[model samples]
Target: MKEELLKTFGAQFETPLIEEISTVGKLAEVPAGETIMDIGNYVRAIPLLLSGAIKVLREDDEGDELLLYYLEQGETCSVTMTCCMGQTKSEIRAITETEVLLVMVPVQKMEEWMAKYKGWRNYIFESYHNRLNELLLTVDNIAFKNMDQRLVEYLKKKSEVTKDNCIRNTHQQIAYDLHTSRVVVSRLLKRLEKLKKLELHRNHIQILEL
Candidate 1:
């Protein structure tokens, strides 16, 4: 676990801080498709992802959810941190995109660590900057990019996150993430297939090239 902390975070964390984290944090394993957090829910703890990925999403009153981004490779979900910090309920949803293992820190420790541990303070600020940049990029994609371009980018991101050239997801699932209809997704996918960019099969999409 210490090795994972160094590999994911860095060697800059003080040994005492690491020891404190090791003591206070509890290990949690979340199965794929499990909701880790939801909108309007008070969170008890924040997770430090050790392995696998979690998808962060925004939802509305109509039950529509849009994929905001993914938290992976030991990254903390800043939205959750914000909610915890402000003593407010979560404004977004988080779900395990894969079988994930994480270290859960008690909610109260967030501020304690910041005031007492330099490493924790740095980690929180870094997490904020990273998440904010990602959100900005997502907004740019939606506001400036076309659907076909966005679809291609989305497919590429999924493949990278899953670490597989062959992605196993249906058109409906893809549509749901992009907040579009299945028909629109299928049409764009067919167009990409015609251009030999990808090969489509039953519940599978094999990438031919970028």
Candidate 2:
């Protein structure tokens, strides 16, 4: 299982060091749409994605589902720092069936590892920096981009069903991804369709560059 994680990364640094990370438990074939961690629940182990994709989503003020991001194989855990810092409530959910390798990593253990292993500590530091940069980018997008621009970019990335070589995604799903109302998405989509900018087939939207 540890070998699988190395696939996501470019190269294996040191086999002996990774092998020394005592395996906690193998969570195999986790069913789709299952909550790996719950809001207000305490998370102990550091989860590493061994296989499958996971969707990180949050609920908005009006009880709407908003997609934060998708986590794929090779990416480390998300929002674990909040859990580590004793934050009781988490705003994300796992939206896909995922196989994860859980390491029994406590805060003290992390400190000890940092103190002893410079290489491991550097890896951890880089990981945190990457995560912080990602969060900052999301915040910048939200603060600077207009709603339509954000929605358009989001749909372009998320449209999974490509029919006839055209990107297709549902309006409701796009609304969830945009953290806005479905009706707003529908209205905008229809307007775009009428303007010959895009085409709509039932719930599926075909993106047109024009």
Candidate 3:
């Protein structure tokens, strides 16, 4: 665990901070599509992703979910950090996009490290800034971009984060993430396929043009 933590975060964190995390953090391995955290859940720990990807989502009152952003290896969730600091329930949901390995650092340690480690404080602030920018981009996509454009961007983002051009999500799954109907997603996907942007398979959509 120590070695993995150092490998993933060593460049950004000091050695002492890494050593402390390895001592106090609990390593967790989660399978793909598993919900690691959800709305209203009290966050007890913040995850430091070591491998694979996790998608963070927001839910509406009607229970529709929208993908906010993806957290890749060597990243953490700022929303979870905020919830941890505020002692509040999670307002968003996090699901493993792939089989993920992460170190779960207890919430209490977060505050201690903030005052004790400059590296930890800088990491947390940078996380907040990056997440805020992503959230803004998501809002812009919804407010300005067409559904087809949004779908294309979404696919590109998924491919970039997972490092796979073959997207395995079903039309319904994509629809759910985009907060649209399956029929709409299917139609757009078909249009893209016709335009040679992608190829539709029985279970996956293979990128041709990205």
Report lDDT (CA) for all predictions.
0.87, 0.60, 0.95
**Rank ordering of all candidates by lDDT, starting from the highest:** 3, 1, 2
Q: Write the per-residue lDDT of candidate 1 for residues 1-210, one digit (tens) a residue.
A: 666666766665678877777888887878988998989999889899988988898886887878899988768989988888888999999988888988888999998888987888888899899999999988999999999999999999988887888978899988888888899999999999999999999879999996
Q: Across residues 1-210, which tens digit of lDDT does each residue of candidate 2 receive? A: 565545543253245445545343344556655777655567665555555666666676776776666655545554765566564566566555343333334544555556666656666676677767766766777899877777766665454311132644466667777777789988887777888878888645676764
Comparison by lDDT, 1 against 2, better one = 1
Candidate 3, 1-210: lDDT as tens digits: 999998999898999999999899999999999999999999999999999999999999999999999999999999999999999999999999999999999999999999999999999999999999999999999999999999999999999988999999999999999999999999999999999999999999999996
Clashing pairs in 1: none
Q: After best superposition, candidate 1 residue 162: deviation in angstroms?
A: 1.1
- Candidate 2, residue 190: the lDDT equals 79
State which candidate has the highest lDDT: 3
lDDT (Cα, 0-100) at 73 in candidate 1: 78
Model 2 scores a C-alpha lDDT of 0.60
- Report how far residue 4 has shifted in candidate 3, in Å: 0.8
Which segments of candidate 2 are over 4 A away from where they belong? Answer: 9-13, 25-27, 60-62, 85-91, 97-112, 159-169, 191-199, 206-210
On TM-score, the leading prediction is 3
